[model samples]
Target: MALSEITTRLTAAAQAHGRDASGITLIAVSKVQPAERVEAVLTEGHRVFGENRVQEAQGRWPAFQEQFGGIDLHLIGPLQSNKVRQAVEMFSAIHTVDRPKLAKKLADLAQERGTCPDLFIQVNTGEEPQKAGCLPSEADGFISDALAMDLPIKGLMCIPPIEEEPTLHFALLAKIARRNGLEGLSMGMSSDFEKAIAQGATHIRVGSAIFGERVPG
Candidate 1:
């Protein structure tokens, strides 16, 4: 589908949930998508995008930025400690900060570089052992730690277990955000973004639905 169509649907979905569509940010997840596909969306004037890998983003975004100024790029996947400096420099937002070590590194880097992207602590709401987020129970402490370091934490983020009801996870994330006095809730994807909107998601990351299915490497 085209960017316009996806955006129109997103706006309608948000409105159906009594949300102001203008308040929601649409992140076109461009991980693993070729540059041409990203360019297609850029051509449609879609500026916010999400990327999974720092290396991949480093390879693609500089060129895209040269052509399209004012683009917002969010890093939405697992982040390695060693890559914290580069990640801080590249992304406009970092959405997978789930541990104290990573949070501290980001804080230090931001202090050194004098630039910090908005931060979101990813919560493993499902308590999935293999996932990359911090346990839901540990989120409060983690957020506290990040804040103590003066990290620019915006809110919480989560990826619900694929087989479970996503709304439940979305609600949990919303509750977490509210309890912590946060305003940004980076939950939802192509499959359940509308439900997420109803649950108060401020940022919805949609990839396949907008750029088509990923081409397997």
Candidate 2:
């Protein structure tokens, strides 16, 4: 699928749910894609992109930026504490702050630099043991702690268990965001972004649907 088609669908999804499509930001997940594919999207005027690995982004984006002046990058994968500084410097947003220690590290970086990317608290809505988000039970306190640090927390993010009904998880995430006064919901991907928008997703991360599947290295 092309970027325009995916964008049109996202817009339609937002409209169908009484949302302004313009309010939702589509992040092109560019991790592991060929440079030509990414450059093609940039040529089409896509500014928002997501990268899973800080090291990969460090090696990739600089040259791309030299070529395309405005790129809004996001970190949509698990973040290690040691990588926080690089992630902070590189991404326009960080969507995987799942623990107090990670949050504290981000807070300290924001303090030292006087600027930080917009943040989203990752909630393990499905209680998936192997996933990277904070458990649902731990989210409230975690969000509270982040707020106290004056972090630029924009909203919440979640990746539903692949086999479950995503609507249930999306609704749960929405409920959590509402209570916490968060408007940004960084959910959804190539397969179910429409559903995410229907549940009030302010940002949807779409990758393979746009760039095609990655060739595993």
Candidate 3:
């Protein structure tokens, strides 16, 4: 589908859910997609995008930013402590902040830089061991710890197990966010975004639906 069609679908979903379409951020997931495809979406005036890796984004977005300003680049993948500085420099938001160690590192960097991108605590609602999120039980304590360091905790993010119902996870994420007074919910992806929108997703990541199948990076 083209960018417009995907956007139309996103808007329709939001409206169907009784949400104002403009309030929902449609994040174009550009990870592993070809540069031409990403540029094509940008050419269509899309400014918000998500990248799965810091290095890949560093290599891909700089030129795009130079050509098209006001791009909001989000780091939507696992983050390594060693790469935080570079990631902090390039991405506008980090959605996979799931541990105290990483949160402390980000807090330190934010203190030194006097500014940092908004953060979303990734929650492993499915409790999948291989996944990159804090467990559901750990979310409140984690949020407390991160906020104690003055980290800008925007909201909660989650990736439901591929085999399970996504709305259950979305509801879990929204519940965690609500109790913590978080307003942003960066949940949902290409397949289950409409469900996410219904559950109050503030940001939805869509990639292959906008750009065709990604070229492996």
Candidate 4:
């Protein structure tokens, strides 16, 4: 599907949920997609994009930025402590800051570089042990730790369990954001972004719906 079509879908989804489409930001998840494809989306007037890995984004972003100014990059995958510097360097916002250690590392790197990117605390709403985010119960503590750092704490993010209804997770995220006084909720994808919009998602990261399947690296 074309970029506009996906955006249209996202807009429609937002409206269906009685949301103001203008209030929600759609981040085209461009992980593993080439620079050419990213440029295509930029040409289509998409300023926000999400990537899962720091290295892959680092490899692709400079070229895209050269052609399109003001591109906002969101790191939508797990971040290692070592990659905190790279994540701080590349992403405009780091969406998967799940633990206190990674958050502190990012804060330290940002302090050294004098640029702290916006941060979203990742919440494993499903409480999955295999996932990267902090469980919902542990989220407040992590958020407390992150708030003490320099990174601008924007909000929360989560990937709901694939087998269950997403609304449950979305509601949980909303509750957490409300309790924490955070406004940004980065959730949803091609499959459930509409549901997310219905439940107050501020940012939706969509990949396959816009860019299609990953092109082999």
Q: In order, how many clashes per candidate?
A: 0, 0, 0, 0
How big is the positional error of residue 151 in model 1, measured in Å on the Cα after superposition? Answer: 0.6
The alpha-carbon RMSD values of the candidates against the true structure, listed in the order shown, are: 0.9, 0.8, 0.8, 1.5
Model 1 lDDT at residue 3: 77
C-alpha TM-scores of all predictions: 0.97, 0.98, 0.98, 0.94
The per-residue C-alpha lDDT of model 4 at residue 129 equals 84
Model 3 lDDT tens row, 1-217: 4889878888999999889999999999999988888888899899999999998898888888999999999999999999999999998899999999999999999999999999999999999989989999999999999999999999999999999999999999999999999999999988999999999999999888889888895
Predicted structure 1, TM vs. truth: 0.97
- Residue-by-residue lDDT tens digits, candidate 1, 1-217: 5678778888898888888999999999999997889899999889999999999999999999999999899999999988888888899999999888898888888888887999999999999999989888888888888899989999999999999999999999999889999999999998998889899999999999999998755
Model 2: per-residue lDDT, tens digit, 66-100? 89988999999999988999999899899999999
Give residue 135's lDDT in candidate 4 (0 to 100).
Answer: 90
Question: What lDDT does each candidate get?
Answer: 0.91, 0.93, 0.93, 0.87
Pairwise lDDT winner, candidates 3 and 4: 3
Check candidate 4 and list the clashing pairs. Answer: none
Off by over 4 Å in 4: none
Q: What value does the lDDT take at residue 203 in candidate 1?
A: 96
lDDT: worst 10-residue window of model 2: 11-20
Clashing pairs in 1: none
Ranking by lDDT: 3, 2, 1, 4
Q: Is candidate 1 or candidate 4 better by TM-score?
A: 1
Clashing pairs in 2: none
Runs in model 3 lying further than 4 Å from the true structure: none
